[model samples]
Target: MVNDPHPPLHEYQRSGDYVVGGIVSHAFILADSIDFTIEPPPPSLEEVTVVPKNYQHILALAFAIKEINENPQLLPNVTLGFQIYNSYFTARSTYHATMLLLSKLERFIPNYICEFQHDLIAIIGGLDAQTSLYVATFLDNYKIPQLIYGPAPVMNEKTPGLPFYQMVPKEDVQYMGIRSLLLHFDSDLVTVKGDICTGEEKLENLPGPFFEMSMTGHSYSIYNAVYAVAHALQAMSSGRLHHKAMADGGVLKIQHQQLWQLHHFLRGVSFNNSAGDMVSFDENGELVAGFDIINWVVSSNQSFQRVKVGSVDPQAPPDQAFTISVNAIKWHSWFNQVQPLSVCSESCLPGSRKKVKEGKPFCCYDCIACPEGKIASQKDVNDCFECSAETYPAETQDFCVPKDVSFLSFEEPLGISLTCSAFSFSLITALVLRTFMKHHNTPIVKANNRNLTYTLLVSLLLCFLCAFLFIHRPEKVLCLLRQTAFGLIFSLAVSCVLAKTITVVLAFMATKPGSRMRKWVGKGLATSIVVSCSLIQTGICTVWLATSPPFPDVDQHSMVEEIVLECNEGSVTMFYSVLGYMGFLAIVSFFVAFLARKLPDSFNEAKFITFSMLVFCSVWLSFVPTYLSTKGKYMVAVEVFSILASSAGLLGCIFFPKCYIIVLRPELNNKEQLIRRLY
Candidate 1:
């Protein structure tokens, strides 16, 4: 239907404190007024789109006010009445309807000047934001409170103090309801970059079975808004009654208060409605009502059906605030009746992490495998984390594995092999010492200073035994003994070899007639060399112990899934210094033995000493780089192997020839073989 002026409306009953005027849109007009000429009266609206659901909003307001007047406990003797007006979905019609609601309703009385005029106390603003704002702005001048029953207005600083209370939840709540619907079906809301829909919309001639009394929609808001005013009026009447009772028997008067000032009474109103839902306002005068989630399904007749699938209550606990029924609703044909997947890339599995894609939204990402020494134990984990000190990432890099207490213990195969090596070398050194003791009086055994020979053999035996310190699980006492014992014992053996080299030189030099070096060729000279050299090493070891000693420690990061119990050289500098000093002794002995190797003395063992020193130097020279490169228990194994190998080299290269002569070639051990070298 097309119209340009006001259609006739049925007259109101004119009861209660004053009529509650409702401004609702029954139809939407197509175009805006174009001509800017001042037409004296407002522009007329035409070419409308009929909306049956909004027309029911007008009926809902009358129903609520009539229901409140029939209730015995509410507004007992004061009945409530209502008057409805058409907004016609236009600004001029909204303003005209609001002005008519506030003007005097009855004018032709016998005593027109003396008769009481019906004034609108409050207004239920229309079914959309534009109509609500128009009526709200006009009513604001008269200090009247307008309740918005449709969409909440997008108010800003410029429109503040307009004095309107929102009856429906804010527009953001509609978006949240949709979000909950998607989340309950295990899907995510996608980002759609598209153009805005700015065309005007009209709801008409497209539906079947449109409205129901039980449906919680915008029409329900109109019903609640009218009852809210009734409760405010009831509260105001009760306060007046209590004030009169407190006075000295004052006569009761009715209908004397200004209804427009009920804005003051409405502010203090808080009560439960007939539906048992509490109707209250926040500090900003907007009602704190949540939204009911409805599923609108278009049937074969092309009409949308509202099904209650969920509700969003802000008053509930945070975790329980939003809920939805997935099976109770229907999905679009594009989803194929199956729940839609989340609008994102496939989730990153365990042992993997998310790598965000460039030039895209944050949720869009690439799933990458976790790096070494770290783990991602959950799906779609944003980042991978390293395990704790006592744990490590599992082989799959999905979870943390507690580290086993690992060491070169006597139980494992490597530890058993090292232990056998140390023990066998120790036994061979002992037997060599015994063989030398049995042949002490022979020219071969007595040629080198016998006392120095005994000391050298003893030190070698101790060196082999010290390897046991590096075999077991490293402890406080063992850590204290491990490096120091190896250093001191190896230092003594190398010093003995150096002293013998010096003794052989001194003996050949002292053999000359009238030589003063004869006095120094005795035990005193060899004794001083051994004692002084060993004493220097002893002092160095003492200082190392006094400052920083080796301590037991665990290596966690050395291996991917194992923690190693090993000795931590407390002062790494001191540890290397000990090895350096022993190396110096070997080098000095090696050069001296090489120079004297061809000396014409049957007892000269300088050639063998040079070979032994060479082996010791080579083994340790390689040990430094290999030790630095290894990790965890493997490092301890390397140190133990080095100790055994170098000790075996010294014992084999130096003493093996003597053992062969003394045990198997006794004929060569006689004095006849001891040809003194002519100096």
Candidate 2:
């Protein structure tokens, strides 16, 4: 004997659920087999057989079931195989067969709602119309959904009164086919004469789009039926994931539930068939599709040889026939209208670009073109690029503007390029004038350490002016200009703070009047102090340029958007760098102020400076955590708050005491009196 190569399924399965096509059933192997003889099931007069005494009908049904099961209509991973019980082969034995099958396959069928009774799972054969009708009534009483092959028309109708979906064609579809044939012939006599002459009338009367008897309809019907079943199987397999995840053999449990799920899933599905139009069912469970219409050409032997008629919709009622009229022809005219094209608005002119209008569409304000040397690039651009010193915009009309300056905002939609650039030049001019005026008034600047005080006052003013760069609204050239001015002013402010700290430290260390370091404390020393601070400011600029420094703490993207340059230090980095640098200044200032306590009260300016450092440190230390946590517009709010607070403190520390002394006590302003009181 040849050995079978296929392994036994017993090894693959464990004691668990078997989900097949969405129907789940628990399988268990009995530990003991009971020897029981066949007997009538509590002989109830209520039980009756519905099939006639013809075995061929039973055989045909068996064949159909076998075909459906064996056909490759289910996914290979979850294929269905059928089991059979040969109920005794006679009409009366139909009930006996059901009972016998139930006993044999009790494991496969589910228990009824009434206390663990297995619902009989048996297929009944309908030899004649009576058997099918009887079976339909019987099944209806029991509420079992069954697949029937009975020839009775009543079986195809609502039997259980529950939803009875029929695969069989109804009488209406048959009548519609005949009407479609008359239309396709396009005969003038049929329309005008209204003569239903003999042979054709009988042909028309034959009640067709008959049960799809022809090879064409039969083939499409069978194909679509099997295809639909395959679709159900596919849905069942794919949708059973939640069940499968529960255990290794949860397929059985998933299968039962998903089977009905598969039915609902396929109800509204539409797919292309051999017929051109989509094949689908309407709200009522009926197949309404446009299939080819074929008419009988001649009778051969006993059967009719049907020829092609045309095509028609099977779902449409027969009384209402398909026709084309002038109204139908006129509907085609809609195709003539052309689609409109969208043209982008022209770009902003040389010095201008489009800015998002504050209130209305297509509304914009023209930006002032920086002088002839300046140029703009990009369309509807916010800002124009400035010509550094060498290059210029190629044309007044062209949008691709050029700039001589090597620097460009990393971000494109920057709004403050020109304003920022102008501000930087103004700051430089102011600083130069302030420096020159102090140097030129030699005698006056040298007296009473006035030059150092003048330089510090000028630095503070420059720092305050730099804050405007952050406004950065829509304007050509303002982007670059803003960054330069703000960056330069911030660097200068930091340098001035450092210089003050150094000045205090050095003054305390140089207590000896004849010390060489003391000789270096006049107008020349003040000039050196300014230049040294300027160098520190320059170093800050170099580092900022290399790193693509960030804007003052604000919305993360706002600085980039407004400045057009990417901020190197984002929230966290920005906080640490700012606090670290300021903290260094605070430490130096504190140490210097402590050491300089011995200095004469007249020159005890270090005390006020140290107090200012403490206030500044306290403000920023609190600002860091809040600044880092906030983002976007809220961050802008926090930054604005910080700016206002810092500015207020600085102004108060520098001017409040002097103002109080001057305004409220004018006599205190007298030099001799103030000096006498302090001493």
Candidate of highest lDDT: 1
Measured with C-alpha atoms, the lDDT of residue 532 in candidate 2 is 65
Q: After TM-score superposition, what is the CA distance of residue 154 in candidate 1 from its true location, in Å? A: 17
Pairs that collide, model 1: none
Query: What ranges in model 1 sit over 4 Å off?
Result: 1-186, 189-298, 301-329, 342-406, 438-443, 672-679
Worst 10 residues of 2 by lDDT: 21-30
Candidate topping TM-score? 1
Clashes of 1: 0
Tell me, what's the RMSD of every candidate? Answer: 10.8, 22.8
| lDDT to native, each model | 0.70, 0.40
State each candidate's clash count.
Answer: 0, 29
Worst 10-residue lDDT window for candidate 1 reads 27-36
